[model samples]
Target: MSRRQSELEGRLDDMLSRIAMETQEIKELEQQLTDGQILANEVLQRDLEGIISGLQEYLRGLRDQARRSQQQVDSLQAENQSLQLHLEDSQRHCRQLEDRARTHTQDMSVQQEELSVLRTEAHALRDRQVESSRQQEELEVELQQLREELARQVTLGQLERGALLAAVDKEKQSTEIRECQLQATIDTLQDEKSSLQQITLRLQAQLDQTRTQYTETRDHLDQTRLQLDRFTAAMLDPQEVQSGPDDLDEDKYRYHYYNFIFQQDLAPAQTARSTKTWFDVHAITVLDWPANSPDLNPTENLWGILKRKMRGTRPNNKEELTASIKEIWASITPRQCHVASRQ
Candidate 1:
C-alpha cells in the first residue's frame, strides 16, 4: 500500500516538474518572441500564439489530471483503509475457520480411534456371533432332546391325566351315590319333619282349643265367683252399715286401688300418696281383707290356693315358678273352683 502511494506521488511530482519546465521554456520563448516579434513574420507570431495557447491548455489539462490523480489517490487511500479493515476481518474469520478445522481434525482423529475400537468390538461380536451360532446349534440339539423328553412326559402326563380323569369320574360317581344317599336321608328327614310338623299343628290346634276351653271355664269360674261374692256380700244379715270419717280414708284407698287396677285417670291427680307406689307395692290380685270380707275379693282366695300349690314345688328360677304357676293355673278346672267356693 505504501509503495502504491509512493508511486502515485512520484507520478504527480513528475507531472509538476514537467509543467514547471514547460512554463520556463514557454517564458523563454515569449521573451524571444518579444525580442524578435517585430522582425518575425505574422506566421511566426501566429505560431507563437498557438504554441502558448497549446501550452496553457496542456498546463490546465496537466493541473486537472493532477487534481484527478490526487482525488484518485485519496479515493484509493479510503478504499485501502476499507480493504485493510476488511482484510483484518477476513483474517480473523480465517483464523476462526482454521481453529474450527483444527478442532474438526482432532474430532476426526478421535472418531477414527473410536471407529477402530468399534471395528475391534465388531470383530469380537462377529466371533461371538459364530460362538453363539455354535451354541445355538447345541441348544437346538438340546431343545430337540428336551422336546422329545417333553413329548414323552406329555404322553405320560396324558396317561396320568386319563387315570386322574378316571379317578375323578369314580369320585364323581361316589359323590353322586353319596348325594343319592344324602337325598334319601334328606327325604327321610323331610318325612319325619312333615310328621313332626303335623304333630306340632295338631298340638297347636289342641293347645288353642284347650286355651279357649280354659278361657271359657276361667271366665265362667270368675263369673260364678263374682256372683257368689255378690251373693255372699248381699247376705249381710240386713245390718245397717255405719259410715265413719275413718271409713272415708279406707274408702278412698279402695277407690284409688280400683282406679289403678283398671287404668283409670290417665294422668291421675296427685293425692296424699302416689297411686304408682301402690301398684309397685301391691298386686291387684292379692289384697288384705278381713275374714268376713274374704268373699268380697275371691281372687285372693284363688291366689292363696295357687300359693299353697307353689310352696310345695321348689323352683330354681322365676321362669320355672312362672311356668309351674301357669301350668297349675291352666289345670284349674271349674270343679276345682266350685269346690274351693264351697269350702
Candidate 2:
C-alpha cells in the first residue's frame, strides 16, 4: 500500500508541471497579440498625421487664390468708374455742340432773308437812276435846240435893224414913228433874252445837284454791302456772334423821308409872307391850307388821283363827298405810296 501511494504522488507532480508549462505558453501568445496591436495603432496614427498635413497645404493654396481674385475685382471696379466719368463728359460736350450749331443755323436764315430784301431795294434804285439819266439826256437835247433857235433869232434881228436904217433915210416923217416902234421891239427882245439866261442857269444848277446826290447814294450802297459781308464772316465763330439792333420798319422809313423832304426842300420856301402871297394869288378865302392838309404838300400826290376819279361823279352833300374820298383813299395800296415817293 505504501508503494502505490508514492506512485500516485509522482504522477500528480508531473501533471502539475505540465499545466504550469501550458499556462506560460498561453501567456506568451497573449503578449505576442498585444505587441502586434500596438504596432498597428502607431502605423495608423502616422498615416492620419500625413493626411492632415496635405489638407492644411490645400487650404493655404485656396486662400492665396481667393486673395488674388479679390485684388483683380478691386482694379476692375476702379477702371469701370473712370470709364463712366469719361462717358458723361462726352455727352455734355455733344449737347453743347448741338446748341451752337442750332443757333448758327437760325442766324444764317435771318441774314439770308435780310440780304434778299437789300438786293430788291438795290434793283429798284438802279431802275430809278436809269430813268433819271434818260430824262437828263432829253433835257440836254432840248437845251441844244433852244440855243440854235436863239442864234437864228439874233441873225434875223441884225438884218431887220439894217433894213430899218435904210428905210429911215428914204422917209424922214414916217421914219420917226417907225424908229420908235423898232426901239420898243428891241427892248422886249432884251427882256426875253435875260429871262432865258436865268432859266438856263437854274437848269445847270439842278443838274449839278442831281449828280452829287447820285454819287452819294452809290457810296452808301457799297458801304452797306461791306458791312453785310463782315457780319456773315463773323457768324462762323460762335464766340464772335452777337445780337444787333433791328432794321427800321417801312412806316418809320417813310416818316423819316417825309421829315427830310419838309426840312430840306419845303421849309426854305415856307415863309409867312410867301404863304400869304400864294393864297392871295390863288384867290383863296382862307389865309392858308388847314394844318396837315394834303394841299401843296410835296409828299401828297393822291389828290390829283382823287380828282380824276371824282370827275363826272357829283355828290349832293359834303358828307357824301367825304365818304367817297375816304373810300378811295382806303383803296390806295402801299405800292402806290412807293410810286408816289419815287416820283
Candidate 3:
C-alpha cells in the first residue's frame, strides 16, 4: 500500500513539471507576438505620416498656383482697361485730326476760288490795255498824215506872202505841241504795261506755290488712309500675326508668343534658341500633341475650328473670310472654354 502511494506522488510531480515547462513556452510566444504587433504599429504610423506630408505638399502647390493665377488675371484685367483707354484716346486724336483736315480742305477751296477770281480780273485788265494800245497807234498814224499835208501846202507857196508865212508859223507851232503830247502819252502807256506785267508774274508765282502745297496735303491724306486700313485689318484678324516659337524659323526661335489664359500669362524669359524681334501682344493658348505641353500659338485647334465655322461652305475671299470670322467668334460656348481651361 505504501509503494502504491509513492508511485502516485511521482506521477503527480511529473505532471506538474510538464505543466510548468508548457507555461514558460507559452509566455515566450506571447512576448514575441507583442513585439511583432508593436513593430507593425510603428511602421503603419510612419507610412501614414509620409502620405499626409505628401498630400500637404501637393495642396500647398495647388494653392500657390491658384494665387499666381489670380494675380495674372488681375494683371490682365488691368491691361485690358489700359488698352481700352488707349484706344479711346487714339480715337479722339483721330477725330481731331480729321476735323483739322476738313477745315484745311475747306480753306484750300476758298483760296482756290479767290485765286480764280483774281486771275479772271487780271486777264480782263490785260485785254482792255491791249485795246487802248491799238487805238493810240491809230491816232498817231492820223496825226502823221496831217503833218505831211501841211508841209506840202507850205512848199507850194501859192498864196499871198504875208498870209503864207503866218500859216507856216501857225502850222509849225501846232505840230511841235502835238509831238510833245504824243510822246507823253507813249511814256504813260509804257509804264502801265510794265506794271501789269509785274502783277501777272507775282500772281503766277503764288498760284504755283498754292498748287504745290495742295499736292503735298493730298499725299499725306493718302498715306493716312493706308495706315488706317492696315490697323483695321490687324484688329480684325489678330491670329494672322500670332505664331508659336516652334513654328518660327531657326533664326527667330528666341521669341515667344505672349499667352493670355483665363487666369494666367506665359512667355519666354530669355533666348534659348535664336534671336529676332517679335510682335509685342498677347496670344491664345494651345496644346502640343506629342509633348503634352501648353503653349501660345495663334493658328491652333481652337482658331481652326472658329475659322472652319466661319468658312461654312463659302468660297474664301476677303469679304467672306471677314464675315465668317465674326460669326464664328460670336458662337463660341462658355462651357467648351471651361473644359479647355482644365486641360
Candidate number with greatest lDDT: 1
Model 1 worst lDDT run, 10 consecutive residues: 244-253
Q: lDDT per residue, candidate 3, 1-343, as tens digits?
A: 3354456556655755665575566556556777777577557556755765675566566556656666877899999999999999999999999999999999999999999999999999999999989999998999999999988887666556778789999999999999999999999999999999999999999999999999999999977765554444445455643653223232222123223433222334322223112232323233323334553343354675575565555746888767767777777776655545455
Query: What's the lDDT for residue 216 in model 3?
Result: 100
lDDT of 1 by residue, 222-258 (tens): 7775555444333442231234322333322333224
What is residue 229's positional error in candidate 3, in angstroms? 99
Give the Å shift of residue 20 in candidate 1: 91
lDDT of predicted model 2: 0.68
Q: Each candidate's TM vs. the true structure?
A: 0.34, 0.23, 0.22
What ranges in model 3 sit over 4 Å off? Answer: 1-59, 78-82, 89-93, 131-343
Pairs that collide in candidate 2 are: none
Candidate 2: list runs displaced more than 4 Å. Answer: 1-39, 113-343
Candidate 1 vs. true structure, TM-score: 0.34
True-structure RMSD, every candidate: 32.4, 45.1, 49.5
Instruction: Give the lowest summed-lDDT range of ten residues in model 3.
Output: 271-280
lDDT of 1 at 60: 72
Greater-TM-score candidate between 2 and 3: 2
